[model samples]
Target: MENIQCFRPTKAVIDLQAIRDNVVHLKNMLQPEVQIIAVVKANAYGHGDIEVARTAMEAGATILAVATPDEAVHMREYFPQVGILVLGATPISFVPYAAANDIMLAVFSQEWVEQAAKQNIDRSLKLHIKIDTGMGRIGVSTRDELQQLYDAITAASHMLVDGVFTHFATADEEDTKYFDKQVKMFKDFLQLLPKKPRLVHVANTATSLIKDASLQFDAVRYGISMYGLAPSPYVETILPFPLRPAFSLQTELVYVKKIKAGQSVGYGATYTAEEDCYVGTLPIGYADGMIRKLCGQNVLVDGKFAPIIGRICMDQCMILLPTAYNIGEKVTLIGTQQGVTISIDDWAGKLETINYEVPCIITNRVPRIYSN
Candidate 1:
């Protein structure tokens, strides 16, 4: 669907129904008692957070998870009553605001808990104890640390231990040795808690989809897969259910002209036409997150693949067309055109990055149009 307000030809189209379907499918695969914590961080992985969160909730997601307190607050504005969890560390100053807004925060250290307890807040602050089984990012590393933090939070009248969780370092990998170790460590941390919190989530999207059903404790943080993307190729090969991708980038050729042999194109004049072939200029470039590294990438044009040629400009780029194509012809940068498909994975492969970074890096300048 196109946005009437967007005058630019380049836009990112989002399929909200695909987001809904992904959540619904994940819900079906999980245990009946397990809750789906839809990870809508990074603006729902650049698909637009509020819209995806709504669709996920409608499809039975019970909670929303974000990477920062600001994101949680942003989500709270749109969803007044929906549960929001900050999956990352929070500033000591944000405690009062989080408590007042009923946003849950991930806590790791006893020092953080002590500092947060000092904040003069009237409402109870909900917290999820992050146990660092092996991620080496955040969370308490040992059972002793976990116990101290748990005790500190319990001692605070205005603080509540809402949940306890950990992140797996290699749930998406073929080798399960480290993954199994993380799982065991997380379980060990849980045992240290005098009583398990209401939520004991430990599985991320990869673990939830491919690991044992027992890992889906109370909830699973559904991130990349919720946007209809596999966490990795290993997980993709063994997915229990197919994911319907929600993001598609598109534009149109504003200028099409035949370049003579030996004629150069774009900045630095890197690409020169070896033969008399038509070169089409698209109204999308590095500024729109079609980075310079993607100059050699293929984009779908009228059911055929056209390679982007020359140095990508800030707001424009040239594609070496197979033949003479008229101006205003539709171009798909990351989507299906006719029967041909150009996926985010294609861009990832070209950029030598992961699929998660493809959509997230697409600048906000490119408006996202939503479709059911």
Candidate 2:
């Protein structure tokens, strides 16, 4: 049978079921009047953008948000019926392509608004004006700036100003003063504009969880949470909902050995066997986006934990497996099955990274297998 197939050192398994659940769950966290814009940028944080985007829309998302124009175009091409907004800036020269493809653009500058008006393209263009209340990044800084751009935008009937939004610099921080200030700034800017926007959004994943009912705008951008992850450190401590992690990484044992005392293992000869012990080699390593820092980490096998014993090489690594598990048996690197567990959060902590980067770190060379 194909039970004994080629085994790789590292693999990332995605749970689309959890993704679907998270989308619906996140949407429910907001009010009925609020809409959800699922942030699918960075390839849905490496959970496969095309797959996650389709799931997100079906689950509860009204619009799919991307960080760049290219990602927006990619999503638009793959899912023609879906609405896409390029949350980041698109060059003036690329306007025709964006309009022809019906991609929404984020306009923060008068220069870009003027360009969109001058382009005078036949197709309709959706624009979401960004505000720089406290993010210290791109967007309109003051109400005066927004009024000028809004006036120019409305003058051009060809362009449609669909929404006005801002980014929160510290929504996830312990202090909510900065985020509170941004809320006021966005509201004040809205009053200055002559036309009322169809949608007003500012909350990202972090702000989406806040208790401030007034902070709730017309919509919110759901990012890391859509992949069953929190946007920041305080989410679990702050939010009412418990976020479930949706990814598990695993591989199989390829070789086994009994190393005598004083035997050194792997590169740099750093690990020395202290006693007569069994060792195992796995097919995963840094090349597969398995961080080498987890060399001393533990993986689960045969309902017991095996400590990884030495420097992690590029294509292979060593694990101290028990005498019970045989070849072709499953290895649990980041999962809980058969009364064993090796959490992805634990793995991320060892690598000195966040849970968000853990998914992104898994290389595309490893195929993602989905589970219920």
Candidate 3:
């Protein structure tokens, strides 16, 4: 086995400038008063949470959003003073933790309200209420039901309704009716409440792109678009500017050999050569988040497209390089060179999944190098 080189098919290049630039662009879209809740969840969509979070706040983010209380805790420990909100339900046991740290929680059920109230209310913890306008997920779902929770939270001196919001299921799709409906429901909640929250946000990245008024609150959570990735394929065609991909991945050619035609490669012998060609082995596979299903995918190498010619192994994969390619040549797994782009979109398309999950699944093992 080779003494695994550093560039061995397992590097994620994150562009800090792209992250900042995306925020600046989003800032341009918003009024001066509209604050941005930078969605740094899923390890900043696998761009490395702390790296992206610090960059986001430096670029005018007023708050940070995460999916779990644990993520909030991580943020609290890593980057203090930044407002962190757990955008989902939390158990009663963690209620004290949330209150203690002043980290906001999203309360959907009255049971959650009753539990939080049961806890000794010192000075009223900041809490955001999630309404299920149509996502069919964790949210109050109805104005009347929300009113009951609202009255209870209001009466409790220890729990202040800090914010009210909802999530959009298909805001990234071409249809806008569903998102508008959710917006109407959010507006209704605003009207129903005796006093509005200090922060009212429902619009995520896709909604922010299509609905200018969607950010009609103290803040809006900027997600995919904040990282310079398109909110959806549809938005790419209509967005005002070309968004640069903030992520790039690289893996260098480690071992290479010219295999004779008729030779099979890798576990299932998934690849059989048509002619004598060079094959480059990369020290990365499913364990590195490059799932076996992507074995047949194309990679940009030496200014040409090379195909992964074998079943991805535990920590190595084979790519059929062009005949002229030599050993030790660097390969671009996800990036642009000579005007050819191999982006997360390409990988997502190859895997029949969304771009969001593609980057998220990159996992934390791979080292992320930040740059301008």
Candidate 4:
């Protein structure tokens, strides 16, 4: 077996410039006073968090947002002064950790405030209230619940309301019925608040890009779009500016051979050659987040397209090549080669998923290389 960690050229190359441009584009599109909170969650959506966070902040983002307490903690190492907001719930037990690190937690219930107040920690915690304006997730759904939660937080000397936000379920879709309903509910929730928080945010990447400008509150959580990815296929068409994808997957051919006509390749003998053909083996497969279902997808080699011929293996996969190639020839699995390009959208379409899942699934084994 080959050494998996040494000399393997498989990498997820990230372009910092694309991220900076995207953030600046979003900043320019928003009102002068509206702030851009770069959503650096999910390891910056699998493009590497610390790198993306620094680049985004340098490009004008004033805040950083993540999905969990651990993520918030990890971000604190690199960004000591910038605001870090946990979009997901932080258990009361971990509340002290967040408060100490100056990280804000999203509270959706009055019970959360009650528990946080019980903690003896001396530091005050900045918090955001998530109103369930229609994501149907962790948020207060009714006016009474909102009022109670607001009062509870305000009552606690250790807790301070810094922001209030909601997520939209259909902001990326073409239809406006559900999207408008969410906006209305968010407005109604705001009406019930005794006094508004310093930051009132509900616009996500999709909402900020395609929805009404009034929805762009004090700040917008720029998530997928900050990484230069369209929120959905529909949003791609209406995007205010062109988005340059910041991610690409690359590798190199490790082995090559010519198979005779009628020969089968890969496990289970699922691929049989109709004629003598060149087959190239790559040092990447399912364990690297290439998942088995993508067995028949196309990969770019030498500026041309090659079909993946059989079941992708745990450590290797076979691609039909036009001709015999050197063992170290470059291969493009998810990027531009010559004039052709393979995009995450292409992979998502074949897998029946979304662009977000495409990069998120590309396991950590593949090293991430950054570029300007």
Candidate 5:
């Protein structure tokens, strides 16, 4: 299980098979020639990158995309031949390492190419030109800037422009107004290119799943949906096939007690029992990525809801149990129990954030157990 020691009952379970299945489903949905670049950045969104990337390649992914050059270097240890694309902007100083490691970088400025070309490297530097259609992130904003970057990279003796892409800022949003605008601009930008690079990608998980598949130029960068969580509710409604969630958080009750009526629980006595009730303590807290704001949330015990009480401590939290339960009873924080289930979306709603942030914040203190 990836050498993840779990002396504590809390753990995150990752289903590698679900990841592979997601890749296969997306692959089947795309055209035969369109590749799938599995995004394994942020440690595969905190599901463990190496395991997820391997599963993706076995299931039909042709390339792996990460957020940083360090991530690309780490992935290279696991995969020597699989193409690795650094989706985020890389420092010019790191260009030599990327070239030596066979990592493709996302280049947006002529200066980066000029800086990279000066490096005394034997291997050719591969690059993916990023155009700022509407994301307002790190990308060339105009046709002139795009051409300049393209021409500069082409002029470089050791730099190879392997791909060109743009990110959609509103693809996951319900309204297609901005989404369509970005798409149109991306298409316009594609026309500006002298010729399409080896990879001409414009679609991400949201666009690929909900938007038109024809927009998938040469490949689709699959991230959140590949982890079995929908990019957005709108995308979930239109998914051509079902996605199996690959992550689950689980723990067990370490201590149990019955408190008298009017007795307060946790720090500052935030919650007071109206009547006598059984309270269960779990060995998991904000330190393990379960933030204190989740105090009023619920965890599953005996297939029933147990409302969390009081301020969540550094290494522990209290839950008002339906009744007295065994100290070793199982608890489901983000997974199925009997029939009921709590999803990352539920936690995202609690945090007022996206589901992608929910799993990614789960710290390394909690061991991640992997299974097929």
Candidate 6:
């Protein structure tokens, strides 16, 4: 997959320097002793994982965290020495590979630990105990469960408890009541452990950015913010430093034509020209992750807003241009054009979703071009 070459005009431009700057800012904000776990899960939230991981490490991140065993293994192939942790549940079958590669697994259940220990592996598998303070996604819930899981891992000569962590459900919100409760529960669970692990991380991107420094503990997992995106609007307001967005969606107009009055553009004949106007077709559409809901959404053409007209097709979509633009004229979907910009947040607003989903939904059909 890495060797596949894409010759498409519609491509995602990734600024690696922005990723480096984000990591550097986060490193400066954390305590001197706190390690930064660069969460490069979901292909670095669709900015490309391996590249982001490398840039983040160069910028001071000490560990790379992914969501699945396959992602961790893929990263391990590129970075043999760097620590890679699987933040999600690992299949028992991956234990041998994880042990052999020195990858860490997030352990929450006694059953998973018992099954993992049965695998025939020559190396010790590093385990991170996950606590479910409130997210209810994964991890042990009660102090008893945490202590029992710790005991099982400690008893297994083939396994080592290297870290313990919890996810926050409200850390990105303005409200602190639920966030405070999760913190207290996590601390209480920590007290149950006979000996603390080398790492006791509890903060995600939101907590690391907006919460108190004490919550940072031994390390903080930097995720959404690592790509220069704030976890939420509330967190964005109180950011300790500015974030430089690293992703930009751009394409050139492939076809342009003038339509007379009453002529419609695109499928379903939804958009009919009331007067003579120009329409430009971009070489990207729903199949490229530009979903159809964005049909009336504004894109940048010649540094001005041009509304997407008609039903967004599978491979192409028409935009109502202010005038007839030459073929190959640049159109900005999620980036700056001249002095104007169409941000990811703007796309999120149009789609009624979060900013994180904007880039992630942009399919791999669009090649990601990295720029340092």
* Candidates 5 and 6, the one with greater lDDT: 6
Cα lDDT tens digits, model 1, 1-372, are: 335488989999999999989999999999988999999999999999888898899999999999998899899999999999999989999999999999999999899999999999999999999989889999889778888999999999799999999999999999999999998888877877788799999899999999999999999999999998999999999999999999999999999999899999989999988889999999998888999999899998889999999999999999999988888899999989898999999999999999999999999999999999
Superior candidate under TM-score, 2 versus 3: 3
Clashing pairs in 4: none
Clashing pairs in 2: 9-283, 9-284, 10-284
The weakest ten consecutive residues by lDDT in model 2 span 1-10
Itemize residue pairs with steric clashes in candidate 6.
none
Q: Weakest 10 consecutive residues, lDDT, candidate 5?
A: 1-10
Tens digits of per-residue lDDT for model 5, 157-219: 988889999999989888999989988888888888888789999899988887887988899
Candidate 4: misplaced stretches above 4 Å?
1-6
Per-residue lDDT of 23-105 in model 2, one digit per residue for the tens?
77777777888888888888888777877787778888978888887787788888887778888878888788778887778
Listed per candidate, the RMSD to the true structure in angstroms reads 1.2, 3.1, 3.1, 2.8, 1.2, 1.5
Full candidate order by TM-score, most accurate first: 1, 6, 5, 4, 3, 2
Q: What TM-score quantifies how close candidate 6 is to the native fold? A: 0.98
**lDDT (tens digit, per residue) of candidate 3 on 26-59:** 8887876999999998999998888889888998
lDDT of 6: 0.92
**Can you give the lDDT of residue 9 in candidate 5?**
92
Clashing pairs in 3: 124-158
Residue 204, model 5, lDDT: 92
